[model samples]
Target: MFGIDVRTARVVWTAALVLLGLYCIYTMRTTLLVMLFGVFFSYLVYPLFTLAQRACGLRVPRTLVLLVVFAAVASIIGLVGLLFGNQIVAEATNLGQQLPKLLQPGELERRLPLPAPLEPLRVRLGILLQHLLEGGTAQALPVVRGLGTSLFHAAGNLIYVVVVPIFSFLMILEAPWIESFLASLAQRPDGRLWSNVARGLNDVLSQYVRALALLVLATLVSYSVTLGLLGVPFTLLLAGLAAVLEIIPVFGPLIAALTIIAVAVFSGYGHVWWLVLFFAAYRIFQDYILNPWLMSEGVNVPAILVVFGLLAGDELAGVPGIFLSVPVIAALRMFAVQVRLHRAARLNAGGAAQG
Candidate 1:
């Protein structure tokens, strides 16, 4: 083999195999993403699955229980979408059609007035916003030029929407085997490390799912009820949008608030000040109180670390990176803690042997 010794030949072969594996992984990254999303969804729904099975009692077969629960979930989602999806779509379409006209030069300025002292700032903000929108549309044009132009992306998105849930269901069916497989990969034969890993992951994952559910539910209910009480038009649409957007970190809520206010301004809603006040109060509640309380026992991460993770993730992998950043961080922290514990245990054992 090109004059290489046997050891060198083995090393080269091993390196080649490693590189080939990496290349294969890179090539199948998109499919891997879909599978990963399926797994993620399964994690979110696992607690619910457990609850459903428990409610079914021991007599009911587990697979049957899962099938029934899955059906119920699908039905509920379909019903809700049927009842509200059209209205939401219509509102979105109207907004899309009207926003360009509404954002024309001075239109925004005329709609949103400020005190004389801040009048110059208002004009500047309007100009800046127009420029941003123009730039954004220009950037987005290629991604959304037309159905024909974006067919591949459209198909990929369809795969995400349609296939992901089915894959998640399949993952749910194989959850126990998957967990065992994961545990078997641990270094310790006694399984203590795997136990810690599994328990830590379960805690964080369940808490994440619970926190997300609560945040979305609370946002939708509070926004809809309060806005409806205050006679806000498009209450359902706005509330639903905010609820859905709650899944995305930081920027999502900000965008929701801005959109709500913008819509209020455009629609001549007299309670713009009240809407602003409500959003500010709700934000304070969400940031300083609600989220902290929900996730305190789980990740318990500092806000600064989460911010850094988000920045790095966004830079490295864009939207999916942002979505996975927190989970990865929490998992890493758990792993670090476990490693420390294992090291301390080993040191103690060695010390006792010496004694």
Candidate 2:
């Protein structure tokens, strides 16, 4: 319109549309997150859906199959929560009460006898805690004041939880159509290319999700059992937190270890040293044996790339980014491999044409 040529006008229109789309996405990020989570969950449960469909001789509605799968999952979660909820709440309350005292200026010194050599370090820590206490109190007042607002915000999360399952059910029902629609965006010659990429990405994501789920479940079960046997308070709560954090990689286990040790110290658990030793051994076992065993067949993503992806994802988008980082990295790696293969094939074709 502003004296632009046809090609230039088309380019300007495309750029404007792209920017508008970006703005829309940014505005709807929260809803998008819920939908993305639903999609990922659908990927994880797709195989079960197929099996259920087959069991019904492919006569039952897809929605019914989804409900069965959802019911099964919800029942397991509800049963576990019912079994341990009260104990976890009580232990969590006690832990909350103890944490402030631990962070107090002289609380650590009073609780733990320091050798003469470490006395200076203890003094420094006390001074640091004093400064932190002053700042923390100021920060805590605002949080306390906003507690009611936070409760309302939490209520909104209920909608998100409801929406996720609904989205997942819909996604499962339309999965085949979605695949075809995506593939059709490419021309005939490139449709197969798009389909292959989609298939590869789907396999990688599903395998990673399943492997991660198994690993987390094993960690939860193993830790809960071991800690309970060792007479740890809040074993269920501690183990559940550990399982959830296990998804975060490297620092997750470290934080979980610290939490258990802190609880032991506060609760007068006599086996503090033993608990520490156990966590150390467990970390070694998990990193060396369990994780590789679970992930090796499916993910096989390099350690360095995983760590880097986690850092990058966390930096960019926080927890959701962290959760999706591994899958995204695997998909990117798959795309790179396919691109390289395609490039090689093109070069071979060109050479034959020249011959």
Candidate 3:
């Protein structure tokens, strides 16, 4: 189109395809983001599907198998929610009650260790807090009002919980058809290119999901045990928080630890040292042993790259980006590898014929 010959037309078309991809990403950003989450959740629950199929002797219909898995997952979530609903509500209420006091500058400083140099900073913080309580209240009034609005909106998340199962069921049932459709779109449908791409995607996603599941389980067990021993209120809620944060990669565990520490400190726990020790131990264990082992087994994405992806995703798509960035990058990486391999195979075949 830009004064290009027939051969150059192909190059231009490829560029156009790239630009079209970028445009699609821009346009379907939210839908694609939600679908990516669906895919991840699908991957996470896939093992349960496989197990169910095997348990049913693999003769049961795939649809039935999916339904069984979906039911099992729903039951578990419902049961847990029912069982811990009161405790979670109580803990949340207690945390809410303590938040104002906890946010006081001197309160945290008095309970937790602070650096010697930060004493002067603490005084400044007190003054700042005083000013905030006075002049900043009016300025912050909008934020308070916005939070109320957000709370109303957040109540709709139950709809998402209902929607997820439906999405997962459709994806599982039609997964094969979806793959076939994608393959049909490729330039050479029968080429090894698509096979390699599919294999790479499967391997990366499955491994990542498995490793992540194990890490989550480990975090839940570790945190639950520690909190139980330390006699922390809301053990289940805190452990659940740890498990959720464990999805964030390296930084997740640190945030979880800090959150646990903060909650424990504010809850007026008698043995804060035990809480601190619990956090420190888990942090060390996760960094030194758990993460290394899991990353080596799973996606092999570099820590720095992961951090950058998280930051970029958070900026672009908020929490969804943080959760999906690694898997999305892994998928893209798989695609690139397939393309490169296809080109290399063609070049090798050409050289072999000449030789």
Candidate models: Cα lDDT each: 0.81, 0.80, 0.77
**Which candidate wins on TM-score?**
1
The candidate maximizing lDDT is 1
lDDT of 3 by residue, 303-327 (tens): 7888988999888876777987898
- Tens-digit lDDT track of model 2 for 152-245: 8869689888888788888888887977786775556656567667777877877777777887888898899889999987788899899998
TM-score against native, each model: 0.82, 0.81, 0.79
lDDT of 1 by residue, 77-109 (tens): 999899989988997788778877887868876
Count of clashing residue pairs in every prediction: 0, 0, 0
Ranking by TM-score: 1, 2, 3
Give the C-alpha lDDT of model 3: 0.77
Q: Which residue pairs of candidate 2 clash?
A: none
lDDT sort, best first: 1, 2, 3
Q: Is candidate 1 or candidate 3 better by lDDT?
A: 1
